[model samples]
Target: MPSSSGRPNNNLLRALSAQDYELIRPHVRCETKAAGELLYRPGDHVGSAYFPCGPSLVSYEVTDGDGRNVETVLVGREGAVGGIVSLGFLPAYCLIVVKFDGPFVRVPIVNIQSAKDRSPSFKNMFARYADCLMAQMFQSTACNAIHSIEQRTAKWIAAAMDRTGENLVPLTHDQLAAMLGVGRSYTSRVLQAFRQEGILTTRRGALIVDDPDKLRLRACRCNEAVKEHFDIVLRGVYPEPDDAAVA
Candidate 1:
């Protein structure tokens, strides 16, 4: 459900002043989307911006020459995806997919552009979010190059958990492998090791985090780095697990 103020449960929207929020509130629509929904493909013109609400999640993926779709960044309630900083319709550079099933707030790009044109502060806020988004991509690239697969796996799970505020991540081994740009066998081995250590357990189509602290212990600092950047750039916009659920 939407909030009492008729806003979606998106932190970026929540961060906007009442006056600025009203500029676009009347134009926004909230809807639930299932996992595996494709929001954008490379070269496609971006028509709308999506803000994941509640436990919903979205990812930017790039297909490598080997035909592997590697995840670049995950956006949850804390951010928006598509033509975020662009002044007008622009071609998407990556494949954007829904990673979790939940409610999302969709705003046509034209409405957003109209709102931005009316309020410089609103535009600045999104520009800062875009900076934070870029920081995540930068850190992810460095992590993939320097961290071991085991560490990366833990970090990925932790990142997802933080965003959804849930222990169970709805992802299959094959899905995880594709996101990590690795083979299913390699992902299975890392998961097996984590299971043996009592950190997490794998279900038919999900991974349950048995102990978040232990999982964090096994993870690299990439997630933390991104969170820190978000804090500095968009202080109260970053979602925390304890944040109240919108109804």
Candidate 2:
């Protein structure tokens, strides 16, 4: 299992069967993931796959008519990024943008795919994770279309909190607006509403959740669904809760 440094509070790696983990051990490389960093963009070759030791925000950007770009999904520690198109030579439809600062375990794409072929148990576990990713992406689409900005913002905040395991989320209104696909003014208004409700506290450029449950209540179903899926899918695959807790 990976040490508790710059890693997300997840049980997946630790929960892995020893034999399965050993197969991929040699290929797991640690790297820094800072906020506002871009991992890969459209047309960039998928060289590595990253699993967060901490929370990260990976967004998929798609250009619409008139060339306006919008985010499709926000990937955090709940799922590994850059694995979908890694084997398929499909051009990227989205960009992986880091939302929080932390460390992540990176494996070369080829190595990861090769490990999948070499280890059946590991392949099954990774495939399950892929399903969770699909669920999140689907939920995001629904949340974007049907939920209010305040509700969606709450969902986003909750997701970040889960990934980073911190209340102080370092994100700006402009960035949030971009991720949420809303006007900057609209994001500001929604944030003010959240602040008034005591669900969040906003400073100059960052936000801190004052009450997690309150945010959960305000969030769309997507927030809960994603967490539930992760819990269900990653169940026996990660270490026990007592064991995976970060130091």
Candidate 3:
């Protein structure tokens, strides 16, 4: 069984051996994060690292001169929210916000650095994870730029479902617009079309995917591209045990 107390309920943590788990166990702290919560603002000081225990989505956003912000990347259970610290940057313009309610384990940055200094293997794992996240971010940029709204939405739904192990995503249309960098009206239209096609079931403030296979088929090539990279590069990070939860 997984150990109790200051620990991360993440793939990386599960992958660790007894000795490796013990190295960083003492410094972890749990936190409850709700939907729409701002995990970190543009210039907030980096104090700790969050490893999501349940499902919590993180969006990277930038504000334009007109005060309108655009999302650049979405992070969920597959990885940690703060990877910029690895590059030695303290405050970045990218905003980290939670889109799903969950419990997360936070380890102080200082403690993480101390563990890195003491363990070469732990450092190697983090370095690899950082690289994987960068690759995913680049893929997301291309997908948003070239993919159709319907295709992109399908991809988003598929990714979220994979992470949460739940079909129901409790998000409002406005939130979806912010995520896709599209207008509210457009998001509503796209969702309406999907519902008509029996691809998704939308309620007052949530979307339930009724047909995942159809959704995948409708998604653009960008979805498959990012997933392929995640599979090849991240490998053991997301385990596929032939179970229905991720299947």
Candidate 4:
């Protein structure tokens, strides 16, 4: 009995043609989730795909043997999490957690499959999104291997800011360290350096980006590389920050 009204704020859903969107419109429902809420864990069957709206964000994290959860990719309003191109109720491979508290559009996997089966364009669009997502994962792997902690930190902040359209990131030093798969001290040093450069400031549980352009200058090209792929594969689907929000 979940109700949905008005146009979806998600970039992926907004990119769909009127005809294609209507196919899944009736089946989609709206829900709000709090930050740090776990939507899916490893081995859980993914029955629905959640499309974040506005500044909502989700992340895929994998736990290592040492019990550290390392983030792989962050999905915001630009795309979706869970069962994008999968068939039936497939088991999730990683932990999917909500990073920002906001509204999300939920569509049953069956409805998505039905829409894709009926429309080649719908299938192609989702398929392209899957490709773009994979490219992001690949670029993140490369960045982790090649970039310095400082560069990675700046890149992560920039990417988050772009999707949320906000200069303030609601993340703690511990959380950022976990996402980077490094010790807190490493991330702290990077953040301290950024603070010294007047690029950002840290609060009790958040970091505020003071100068986005300066932060971008310190970041590696991994974000840009992934964004370029997204542009080529799904133009206008990637989220861009509003000028006033970032400024």
Q: Candidate 3 lDDT, tens digit per residue, 157-221?
A: 77777666677888889888877888999889988988999989988889998988888888877
Return the top candidate by lDDT: 1
TM-score of 1: 0.96
Of candidate 2, the 10-residue stretch with the lowest lDDT total is: 238-247
Clashing pairs in 1: none
Arrange candidates by TM-score, descending. Answer: 1, 4, 3, 2
* Clashing residue pairs found in predicted model 2: 7-53, 7-54, 8-53, 8-54, 11-238, 14-239, 15-238, 15-239
Where does candidate 4 stray beyond 4 Å? Answer: 1-5, 243-247
Give the whole-model CA lDDT for all candidates, comma-separated. Answer: 0.89, 0.71, 0.71, 0.89
Q: Rank the candidates by lDDT, best first.
A: 1, 4, 3, 2
Q: Count the backbone clashes (under 3 Å) in each candidate.
A: 0, 8, 0, 0
The TM-score that candidate 2 achieves is 0.86
Looking at model 1, residue 165 earns an lDDT score of 82
Q: What are the TM-scores, per candidate, against the unseen true structure?
A: 0.96, 0.86, 0.89, 0.95
User: Which regions of candidate 3 fall more than 4 Å away from where they truly are?
Assistant: 1-8, 83-89, 239-247
Give the root-mean-square deviation of each candidate in angstroms. 1.4, 3.3, 3.0, 2.8
lDDT, candidate 2, residue 220? 80
Instruction: Tell me model 3's lDDT, rounded to 2 decimals.
Output: 0.71
- Tens-digit lDDT string for candidate 1 (181-204): 888999899999999999989889
